[model samples]
Target: MHPVLFKIGSFELASYGLMTALGYAMAAFYLLPRLKKINLDRDTFWNLIFIAFMGALIGAKLLFIIVSWPQLGATTAEKIANIFRDFRYGFVFFGGMIVSVFSLIFYMKKKGLAVFKTSDFLITALPLGHALGRIGCFLAGCCYGRPTDMPWGVTFTDPHALVAPELLGVPLHPTQLYEAGGNLVLFFILHKLYNKPHKNGMILLAYISCYAFMRFIIEFFRGDYRGAFIFGLSPSQTISLLTALAAGALWIYLQKKETKNG
Candidate 1:
């Protein structure tokens, strides 16, 4: 509810940004030790992190613009202008994931690093950071849930909340917290899987499968402005379905390959 976390002389700090920074910082802290364990050079590891971060930011914003294009404006000029005007807000997590993965792969290859091995380390840290980002979503009141009469339903009355004007003060499902909890659980699962012996891409596939499923289910409760629905499924849900199928296929392929080699 406290979107503006604090204020100083003519300056205000946002909870969403703070939480996101904290999440990234924590992820970096977790990653450093893992990188050392994997024998990746510290300087190279930091460079990869920087590249992934930039890619994630750009991808998140770009996907948001594409998805929300219909609502941007009536004319092409206005739509283009709107993108720049509203640049500070709006992001899609899946877009960030896809772009970050590509960025990581490209950078690893360019640097002559082991891509899959490095990815195993990175994927394990992703959910922990994502969980904090969801907490930011909750505080900012974006990514809100549908109205619910359940006892645990939450009401957002803050004028600055990202909840739609109509839904302000109305009880909703608190879906942000739900996703945050799910991501935290996913982090633990991936961490454990990392410790145990497994196929190279298993942890990454596991993350995709678990996250896509969680996101697909959570989308059912989301009431915010999700753009473009087809066959009664939101854009995110559609992507989730595709991602889940792809992950399953990849999992099967990896397992078979491992068996053949064994």
Candidate 2:
């Protein structure tokens, strides 16, 4: 809908960037106090977040370039030029998630922190931030939904919007909001889980399982050009399947271990 949130004399503020920043701010606000309560070093926690953020930025852009390479241009020079032009608005969430996890793990180890407990503390904020990011996607008209006749279908009329040019003005499913809503719900559920005394890695496992399932279902309604498909499933969906399975197995193992110790 409203892609440009505001404009100054020559400079324009994008709704997507604003919303994403708000999400980060909100997550930080929620996290800082919790870090103190949990006895985690505030400096270490903030450092980990910064590292994850940088890693996510790089990974998301790298994956986007890799997946969209062929479509960038027909010639080498054209492709190189297109890279600079297209750098503004493309990212894959899974790529960011993958890289951020590895980065956080390495950082935690380097700092001599308890990895699982630190991850559990940090991950509770993820869905909350992710929900806002999805709303940003909605406003920016990226990650749009498939065509639909439903009354809730949204039409993107802004010429500056990122929705595919051909799909402009067409009624679409509003998949961004769908995921946003799902993530909000997930945030609350994870918050409750975090408050309760649970296994060390339960929160992380829960997030993975819940988000994987949500992403898998939501992929069906996604209309945007999301990378390649393998065996009739989109890249995200394939990753979701594997992530869900792995998380479920780990969750079970953790539960058994806790029970044995108890």
Q: Please, what are the lDDT tens digits per residue for candidate 1 over residues 74-178?
A: 999999998887454678888887798888898889988877677888889988998998899899898999999999999999998889999998999999999
Per-model TM against the reference: 0.94, 0.94
Model 2 poorest ten-residue lDDT run? 83-92
How far off is residue 199 in model 1, in Å? 1.6
Error of 2 at 120 (Å): 0.9
Q: lDDT for every model? A: 0.88, 0.88
Using alpha carbons, what is the TM-score of model 1? 0.94
Question: Considering only N, C-alpha and C atoms within 3 Å, which residue pairs clash in candidate 1?
Answer: none
What candidate 1 gets wrong by more than 4 Å, as runs, is none
Off by over 4 Å in 2: 252-262
